[model samples]
Target: MTPAQTTRRHVLVAIALVWALVCGGLGWATRSAIQLDSFEAREDQRRTDEVRMERALARMEAEIAPVLYPERARPYMHFRSYYIATEARYRSDSSDASRDILVASPLKDYRGPDWILLHFQVSETEGWSSPQLSSEARFALPAGGIPAPVRPREAAPENWFAALQERYTAPMLEQVLMETLIHSGEVEGLSAAGPRPDAAPDAESGVRTAAAESARRAERLLQMQREIHPASTCEPELVAMENLEAGSGQVLYNRETGACVQVYAPLMTPVWLDLTQDGEPMLALVRSASVETSKNCTLQGVLIDWPKLARELTEQVRDIFPEVRLKPLLPSEMAASATVRGRLHTIPAKLVAARSPPVETWGLSSGLIGGLAVAWGATLLALVAITYGATKYLTLAERRMQFVAAVTHELRTPLTSFQLYSDLLAEMPQESAEKRRHYAGILRAEAARLARLVENVLSYSRVEETAPNLRLAPTDPSNILEAAAAATAEPCQKAGKELVIENHCPRETRIETDSQFVVQILTNLVENACKYSADASDRRIWLSAAPGPGGSITFEVDDAGFGVAPKDRRAIFEPFRRGTSEQGRRAGGVGLGLSLSRYWAQSLGGVLQLKRSSRNGAHYSCFSLTLPSAPRQC
Candidate 1:
């Protein structure tokens, strides 16, 4: 190899290595970027899931709060009376020594603690007597007086009062007192009052004066009650309550004065009223009706089912954050730093999500990236192929240019020889006939060489432009070989080379092919052998034909010459591709002979190929032409 060629090869190798490294580095960087993006995406998804879980937990807690603490609900129960006529009748019997009567009080329908009534004695002569204290003071009795009470036949009066005293203990009295202080107005007529207008000329003065007078009277009444019941430690305080006209129809009247009074206490148990003139305290009847408790103890009269509520909340969280898996944790197991906690009634639970978000590679879509990579690779390959094709095209073009220059030089030389020899023949007519004949022969040979060059160029151009037009006919292979050999026999003799034709084809064998094209194939191959082997020590050309496989015929042209180089053999059949050898370069023809011969053989529905060429032992080269056998005529 030449130094220039070796340097070029090394440069190409280095460039390929650099390009490969660059591609590998780019691929690795792309993979790392995708991994980083995916990690970030997972983190984002995790944060989002935590927030969603927190919201769900909060919603669940709100829903179940009331169910867990029912006392937080609003109050709905109010006081109403229930009658105890049986106890009233027993107390009214004349033989009874009990000072007070026992009756059921209002609030019987409530869920906790029973209620009762106690009627103690008070009197007009005993300073506890007043018109407000008497039940008959405001409303006159009906013609039949009051309704007769029902008596329980099995009951004993003595046992009943003793049992009542035991049940209404000190704690019960305190509870009733507290209830009176807290829910007095709420339970009875006091709650239905507002401020009243005064009848005096100065309204503000009249209100103050009336309030002072009412206080004095309440103080005097309280003192009288204390004197009458000296054994009791209960201290009753008076409170002023205004009356509003919009109140419901249950008015509490002061039996002593026979006037409406908003100042009253809740009647869960009984208190003494100074009703009779006899000095014995008359009973205030107390009865209890059913009171609603559950409605008052719950929010909006509805109880929440916490388990179902928790489940629904979990499902909602799952729907919103599909990638996160929620695991419920027990109250003890729940960490303070956990993502979120949920409660159902009093039960505590925590929401735990999966440790990682769903598996995915982030950044650009994988399919899009893959598609781009494939397209980029395909485009790169296409570019490389285009570059390689362009380089080959340029090389072939340079060779063709060289071939054209060589043909031109070859044509000029023969034309100059023809002109020179014709001038000599015309000028030396008086010379000997033999000398004139020699000049004529030189002109004819030069003309034949020029004609062969021109014919090869025209034929190659024609075959390249379009498919060759072949005149198919029946012809013997030997006849075609002999004709080509005869045409070159004289040229071989003058050039001091032997031309031999060995016909191995049967006498009856004929091929269907274009006869002129077959002869041209044989002539071109033989002529090339003669030209390339001109300087051989034993110069010889061999033309032979024989029967081939599949009822075909094979024609071969062999020469004792420097065989085609191994590297150039494949390319030798390409236009303008000549052997790179001293003998081949010194030979006198353009490089179209083999290429055109191959084209013509192909046009005849046959093939022309280098059958064998060896550099060893006289450097023999052989080219073969194979054609199909023709049908026999009847």
Candidate 2:
């Protein structure tokens, strides 16, 4: 390669290397940025998941507290009577606070010396016996004034305690306790107090109305009191002992005290006895369970389905992060380095998961990398294409400049000849007619050559601007050929070259074409054949017309000349391109003949082509023109 070509190659290589380095750096930077972003996102997700699990566990614990505590208290409530209740009474006379008395049962062992045996009255008038009596004899009742006679033995402290225990069964206590635990302190009243006496009425009817209204008001007050004091019983005189209904065991919370109060809905109200004749009634018996406090109650150690909880957490987290898996851990198993753990509110458990979930890298970044690569490739291709186009444009501009110089040279030669010949003719006297005629002929010939060159230039310009204006008509193919040959006859004779016209087409053959354009094409080809073969020994030019394939007409021009080189054949048809043949080298015409002929022939709906060229001895070249045949009717 030339030094200039070598320099260009090195420059292109350097640009390619620089572009490669830039792309490589960009790719590495993009990968690093993506990795850093992914790391940050993963850490954020871990923190977010930890917070989410903590909230979920808190909610779960809140939900599970009520269920677990109630379930834990169920068995205790069921067996509360057997474990908690005894025949016990507070000592009224004891100054020492520790001297409280518990009456012992005869069926069970009693080791306490401070414990006392006290009698319970069988009838209202019969009061409790002193602790000094024996346990069996202390329960004897008075002989007379008993409204309802009872067995004296049954009133003993041990027997009364046993009866009370049997009467308030385990199942009843259990129901009361369970209700109290669940509903807290809300309860319904068993009975209301009797109405108080209103003011004296003016009439008996008025007295009756006032009494009824007073009774209704008292009933409402009792309901209100029940609601206000859900954990307490009503006053005894106001409430009719027999009218009271059994309570429905339901629990409720006391908002003021934050206490779990159980309502032992009374199974039976107090029974009154008129044992004393003083017209006063005393309570015979009242059977009811005492209210129990649930402050120390607990429901810890309740079993929680940990696997199910983990699976549920996994499902919940998967909705937010599809690739994550949540594992359940005990409080003891939460120290693993790879695992992140959070406490569950519902149970004593922890949730564990990977800090970074499994994710497919290709799904996230392959498309990004591929897109970047494609964009880089497209940009590089565009840069290379732009460089090549600019180079080609510069080369064409140089060729155009050379063509301008050649055209100027050709124009000056013809102009100089015209000037010289015209000056000689103008100065010659009228007597020397032969010399004047000779000068005039030379001037005309030179002018004709100049006109042909100018016409070719103008025609090329028109073709370049748009299409040629073809005045198409139906015409005899023979007439067009004959006219072209006749026009070239004078030029051939002046140059001392023989011209031949052979018509192989029928005389009646007609074609549709612009006659002027056809003649121009024929003239250009004939002129080219003559000028390029001027140095040949034969000095012969032949023009022929014949029928062509596809209902077309053909015209051929042949000459024995130095043929165009194979490498330059296609180039010679370009505007401003001339043959590299020896004859073409010495020729004085601009290289517009073949180019214009081909353009005009195409405009007239035909073609002009170099049929063949010979490089051997007696070199020959032939050019052919083909025009579409007109319809027979046209």
Predicted model with the maximum TM-score: 1
| TM-score, every prediction | 0.50, 0.46
lDDT of each: 0.51, 0.53
TM-score result, candidate 2: 0.46
Which tens-of-lDDT digit does each residue in 1-634 have in candidate 2?
Answer: 9655675577667667766777687778767766765665566766787676666555555554554444323221121112211223447753433223222332134222111222121111112221223445423442123343352322334443333233333223222323322222233433233335756666767856644543343334334323533444322210111112111121123333322334322221112222233333222112222222211111111112223334555566554445544343321233341233555433324445445454434334556667667777886687677667655665566557657877898899889998898888889899999999889888888888788778777877787677766577889877887789888888787667888788888767888888887897888888777787887788878888889998899898887776667688688888888887776778766787888888777766677777574332534378888888852211
What lDDT tens digits, residue by residue, belong to model 1 across residues 83-181? 112212344565433213333333233232111121221111111111112332223321112222321222222222333233343223222322322
Q: After superposition, how far is residue 35 of candidate 2 from its true place, in Å?
A: 11
Off by over 4 Å in 1: 1-354, 357-366, 381-385, 426-429, 613-620, 631-634
Q: TM-score for model 1?
A: 0.50
